[model samples]
Target: MESFFEFRHVYKGFDGRAILHDVSFDVRAGETVCIMGRSGVGKSVTLKLIMGFLKPDSGQIIADGIDVPLLSEAELTQMHKKITMVFQSGALFDSLTVFDNVAFPLREREHENEAEVETVVTGLLSMLDLNDQRGDYPASLSTGMKRAVAIARALAARPKAILYDEPTTMVDPMMSHTIADLIQRVKRQYKLTSIVVTHDTSLARKLADRLIMLHEGGVRFFGTVEEMDASQDPVVREFLQQDELALP
Candidate 1:
């Protein structure tokens, strides 16, 4: 299988602190990989590094076989065009209505007419079960609704790879699984390669085709879901044992 994204012994730091250390992982095309870890273990940092929002101190981050570390300003913008992120807080613009908010990226990048944009955005919102809230403002929507809108907006660009940051955050049990199912559908239906940053074990178990567990900014485990469940390493077992709390 071809790896669409690869972390090649990546090392990154801030000020006088170190996070990732010789961190290496890969996301194969058409696979959904969920990153699982405890708080401050650099799970989210890994995603940011891959997205080129933060630079790695040493080593390479390759996406589609191109070393992301070498990408120029224009290349970075183009890369972003093919990759989208669903923020933890939903990241919807406060002033824009749901339709305009979802349409923003599409309008910025593509010369799609208003009708074409509306059709695509409406389809996405419908897929996410957010059709009714299309006319509402971000503030008027609930947290779950906002997240759904954020996802709808992310789809506007028709990204090849999606980075999900704590998608289960701010959602209750009733609506949490919808987000999970949507991610699954987005991967299978759209043939997307997704990198999900989440500490929610249940979500990981449900969404991950492969699971990578991080500890102290280093990878402690990497394998199929069954392998994680059957892990013998104490740290691995201990980490798996905390599946109940679901804390980040």
Candidate 2:
């Protein structure tokens, strides 16, 4: 598969401290790559750079054929149509019902056909097991349900690529499994290029075709799960050991 998202020696910083330095990785088309690391290792920053929410001080962030950092505001808007990010917070509009929230992107495209929007929204909601909550507001939903709704909203845009930021954090084990399963279902059904930033080892093992382990603003390991398991690097071993210890 061709590279859908490429980060080449990317650098970004806040204040005088660098959060990412010489970071690089490529997510292939139709492949799922998970970004993993301890807190403040620039895991989420990489996703923002891809979305042009934050600009790198130097280096290239190529999404599809466009160099993300160099795009004009108008150009970035167009690019955003083909790519979407599912934020960790779920970021739903409290005023919009589940149906409307999932339908928001389709409506923004000026479809004019309400029936089409209804069909798409209903299908996504049912697929994500949100059919029962379609009329509910964000305030009423649990954390996992909100994330599922957010994923539904992201898929509603029909993006070529999807970025997920910490999909299973703060949820109970059952809900965490549900979110992971929903993500895997989306991957198999949509065949989208996916980049997931998560610290959950089980989630990573389940969804990642490859894993990028970041540390101290750089990539410490980048390879398949088996390779990661076989890795001799002390950092990788220690991370795995610690994650295992934290599991319930």
Candidate 3:
């Protein structure tokens, strides 16, 4: 199958310090791939590059047949219609209510009339179990709720692919499980091509069709979750060990 997204020999750096070195991977359509790594290991950077938020120092980043790094500002905006990132911070509009926050994308991107937007956004909020919070603002919601709103907003855009950055961080285990299940449900429901950047092995295990472990600025391991578990590579083993300790 043709790759829906790809990073071919991707190299990125800041101030002469390399962050991603010759990183290469392909995510086929409808497949979920988890990019696992410790903090500051370019997990989020990969998403930024994919989103055209940052340019690669060298190498190609392709999504949906467009060369991401080469897209112009206008072109990038158009490309964004097919891909959306759910930020770790749940970057919702502080001033907008949950319903409006979720509707913003449809209003802005899809230019859906208010009635149509309301129909879609209301269904999303109801489906996601945020109906009670629809009138609430972001500041009043819990971290998990904020993240759910962010997911709703992403879904409003009707993206073919979604990038999740450190999705379960700073939340309690119950909330993490809730968010994980949400991700799983959305992916299965939409048949989305997904890239989840996380260090949470449990989340990775639950969500990934394949896993890529990033270490020291490169892909240290890339294979199925079962292969990852059975690997003898010291680096991969170290991550697994840390993951074991992280579990309750």
Candidate 4:
């Protein structure tokens, strides 16, 4: 099967400082691929490139058959309807209630009527066990609740692919598991292609059909979870060991 998303010889840098170098990978439709690396390893940068938030210095990023870098801003906006991102910060609107936040994408991008938006957002919030929070605002939510609300908002777009930027970061162990399980559930239910950028090896093991390990601006490993576990690279082993030690 051809790749549903691809990064070919991607190279990105900032002010002469290289961040990603010759990094390349692919994700098939309906597959969940986790990108894992230590902090500042370009994991989130990869996601930003995919979302067209940043451009690679020299590379070709193809998503849904569109050359992302080549698309105009307006074209990219339309393409965004099919590709949504859930930021690690849970980038919710402070002014909107949870219901409205989840419903925002549906209303703005998809232009679904109120009745349709009501049905979709209602079901999503309910599935995420966020029904009671619908009336609440971001300021009133805990870290986990805020992340849950972000996930609901991302789903409101009914995206073909979802990019999660550190979905489990800064959460307690229980909440981390909850977020991981929720991601798995959504992927299976929607058959959605997902790219999760996280440092949590445990979460990667749980949610990744395949793993891409980045080290020093390169792909150190890209294969099944078992392959990653068996990697002989010292960097890979050391990174995994460090994460294991960090667990409580």
Model 4 regions lying over 4 Å from their true place: 109-111
Q: List RMSD in Å for every model shown.
A: 1.7, 0.7, 1.0, 1.0
Writing each residue's lDDT as its tens digit, candidate 4 over 1-248 gives 76779999999999999999999899999999999988898988999999899999999999998999998999999888899999999999999999999999888954568899899999999889999989999999989889989998998888999999999888888888889989988988998899999988888999999999999999999999999888898988999899889877
Q: In model 1, what are the clashing residue pairs, if there are any?
A: none
Q: In model 4, where is the ten-residue run with the lowest total lDDT?
A: 105-114
lDDT-based ranking, best first? 2, 3, 4, 1
Error of 3 at 246 (Å): 2.0
> What's the CA RMSD of model 1 in angstroms?
1.7
Q: Candidate 3 versus the native: TM-score?
A: 0.98
Most TM-score-accurate candidate: 2
- Candidate 3 lDDT over 137-204, as tens digits, reads 99999999899999999999999999999889988888899899999999889999999999899899
lDDT of 1 by residue, 1-248 (tens): 99999998899888869888899999998888999888888988888888888889999999877788788889988898888888888889999999889989989965688888889988888888888878889999888788888888888888888899999876887788888888878777888898888878888888889999999879999999999888898998888777755454
TM-score versus the correct structure, for each prediction: 0.95, 0.99, 0.98, 0.98
Candidate 2's C-alpha lDDT? 0.95
Q: Which is the leading candidate under lDDT?
A: 2
Off by over 4 Å in 3: 109-111
Model 3 is weakest, by summed lDDT over 10 consecutive residues, at: 105-114
Flag the better candidate by TM-score, 1 or 2. 2
Which pairs clash inside model 4? none
How does each model score on lDDT?
A: 0.86, 0.95, 0.93, 0.92
lDDT for 195 (candidate 1): 85
After TM-score superposition, what is the CA distance of residue 165 in candidate 4 from its true location, in Å? 0.4
Q: What is the lDDT of residue 158 in candidate 1?
A: 85
Q: Per-residue CA lDDT of candidate 2, range 136-214, in tens? A: 9999999999999999999999999999999999988999999999999999999999999999999999999999999
